[model samples]
Target: TDFEKEIKGDMLSSFISEVRELVLDNCKSNDGKIEGLTAEFVNLEFLSLINVGLISVSNLPKLPKLKKLELSDNRICGGLDMLAEKLPNLTHLNLSGNKLKDISTLEPLKKLECLKSLDLFNCEVTNLNDYRESVFKLLPQLTYLDGYDREDREAPDSDAEVDGVDEEEEDEGE
Candidate 1:
């Protein structure tokens, strides 16, 4: 489809099975569990559940095609190992603003061999000594941490110019 399918700020129960992208940020769950998700979403590629009050991700349904998942601003303390199986193809994961406290808590993520980018902004683990070095050592497969690499190079912005397409040049041509 030409248009991206996105469901933002909506109740989980109202989500469509065929949607490829879903954003349910700020939708709270009573038991801190992901409800209303099923294995029926075979086509889903991206999912964002920021600020959803989730304390654990044990309830997530299998999403084999999922490549990017955003679970930032939640209350999650751990139980991330399940994501390796549930979202097997996940390449990017954002767990910023959560309750993660130690680098040991992220050891389970090593199973996610495809994960290239991981963001842990505002998490307690970031305050640990040698945080960046520890994480890079633990998850050697990771290419970017908190948007930067072990070499301290920042990841390119998604909106940055590509293939020399400049707005000023386009306007001048007009």
Candidate 2:
């Protein structure tokens, strides 16, 4: 088959359970779309798909051994709670440059006690408003809250803001 210089997509596709790391960045899927790794390669420990517009991945099969998943630069905007259920062994995750609306989707990750690092650099995150405070509730074993950089575990302030003491209480009733 000289016309076929080389064919090697499905070859690696079926070898999922045997594979711990699979990288198919920028590969055109059967739908003639360049996106994240096809669901055919589901059970991988390390997955990296940079600069790919992976819009949806709800069809992926279970990946129990998956320890690390890197899907940066994609349009992934779905709840991430399912991942914790599917990949209990997940420890490191990177989803930078994607459209992540909220971190509440990560609440389920508390069960993944082994998780150590996570990255969501310039996604659709606005501020540490919604679930950022909740992230500090526990995660005692978490060394690096986001990415490899360890976060400063600051305690939440309990006292309300002291705007201004009442003049009466200040003995200014003169």
lDDT by residue (1-174, candidate 2, tens digit) is 743434444455556546667786765444324444444555577766666556755544567777777777877786566666777777777777788776665566677767766667786563556444455454544545453323454312212211223323455568
* Candidate No. with top lDDT: 1
> What does candidate 1's lDDT look like per residue over 1-174, in tens digits?
323333342334245556798787888876865666678777888889999899998888899999889999998999899999899888889999999999999999999988888999999999999999999999998988998888897776743422223334334553
Task: RMSD for all candidates, in order, please.
Answer: 8.3, 13.9
Q: Which residues of candidate 1, in runs, are more than 4 Å off? A: 1-17, 158-174
In model 1, residue pairs whose N, Cα or C atoms come closer than 3 Å (at least 3 residues apart or on different chains), thus clashing, are: none
Alpha carbon lDDT of each predicted model: 0.84, 0.59
**What TM-score would every model get versus the actual structure?**
0.80, 0.60
